[model samples]
Target: MKTDSLSAKAKTRIKRPPSEVFAAFADADLMSKFWFTRRDKGLKEGETVKWYVGSDDGAFAFDVLVKELRKPERIVIEWMGQDGNPARVVWTFEESEQGDTILTVEESGYAGSNDAIVERALDSTGGFNQVVVAAKALVEHGVEVNVVADHVP
Candidate 1:
């Protein structure tokens, strides 16, 4: 069998500590405020979480398998992409000397036609970028930018 894959990466520096930034992703409630519309539970290693977007009629849902979780540092998860390909997403949090956290998101394992792989990778990059930006706004200024929701509708 032939194997083809693509990956996307995005990074952002938030004016907050690593712990705070990490919590923004680990906790379901906090994440809902910035990213996903709703998450069934907090992220934990070896656990599965359901995330939903939009209302009941038009809602899109997906299951994320938490592959790894390191508090204030890193997290890895696997989920099915829009194209039905298994994708792995990694989040890394690094604390800088200026008392800020640099968060990086990498997603890989898009397998399909060249065009489909490229499209998925590009979309993942933009989505992750919006996630981090929304997280920064929520964490630093206590404001929800609603970037995730904005992208949906």
Candidate 2:
């Protein structure tokens, strides 16, 4: 059966430099503070990383293969979706005129039924929004708001 693919994109402006905002996602230590509960290590091209969320009891664990990594600019990774199909996630970081960073997240290659693809895309949009907001709070204000975790359970 031929399956349809879907994609989602989200953008946010953070009150920090592009390097700082990029570090928030590239560095496992900083990412764990706001997004995932734990990550094996920092993102590197041609490497795979495991990220755990929620309780970290192995219930919500996923593996991400880093396809490309450009410091303070862009990162691309492939991960499996709920349907067990691999999907690509790309993150772009651009420095704004006001010294802030404009972060854009795009996920594509979702293969499934129409309803499933739409649902997954919507969920990704909301999830990425929460993640960027949380990262903003943590990086700009030094506060761990836990917005992403709050939506989990």
Candidate 3:
């Protein structure tokens, strides 16, 4: 079913500089405030870090290997997603002349039938939408809407 060809992308324009916007995703500590509840370390090239989400009682952990890390621009990571299958996620930041940044997140790879893969991609798209929205709120306005955290039980 060409799982390799199925990728989900979500993008948003944040009312902040690229570096500031990128920090929310590249720095583990800063990331906790906007998205993904916690992480072991910041995103760095060739490094693998453990990231956590959900509440204390419902914590979900995943190992992410930073494939590429370009400050204020892009990040690429591979993690065990899609029911333990490896998936790649890329984050890109394009700064506008007015100091704002356009942020994009793309995730690909999975194991399943065509329908299952399509379903997963759709779910990832929605989840990424929540991620970017919450990130914008947190970074631009210092508000945690919990858009990602509140989605699950």
Top-lDDT structure, candidate number: 1
Cα RMSD, each candidate: 2.6, 2.5, 1.9
Off by over 4 Å in 2: 1-5, 55-59
lDDT per residue (tens digit) for residues 1-153 in model 1: 232656788899999999999998899888888887664668879988888775365678889999999998999999998788899999999999998999999999888888888888888888888888899999999998766678852
TM-scores of all candidate predictions against the true structure: 0.91, 0.90, 0.90
Alpha carbon deviation, residue 28, candidate 2 (Å): 0.8
Candidate 1 has which clashing residue pairs, if any?
none
Query: Using alpha carbons, what is the TM-score of model 3?
Result: 0.90
Give all candidates' CA lDDT scores.
0.86, 0.85, 0.84
Clash totals, every prediction: 0, 0, 0
lDDT of 1: 0.86
Better of 1 and 3 by TM-score: 1
Q: Arrange candidates by lDDT, highest first: which order?
A: 1, 2, 3
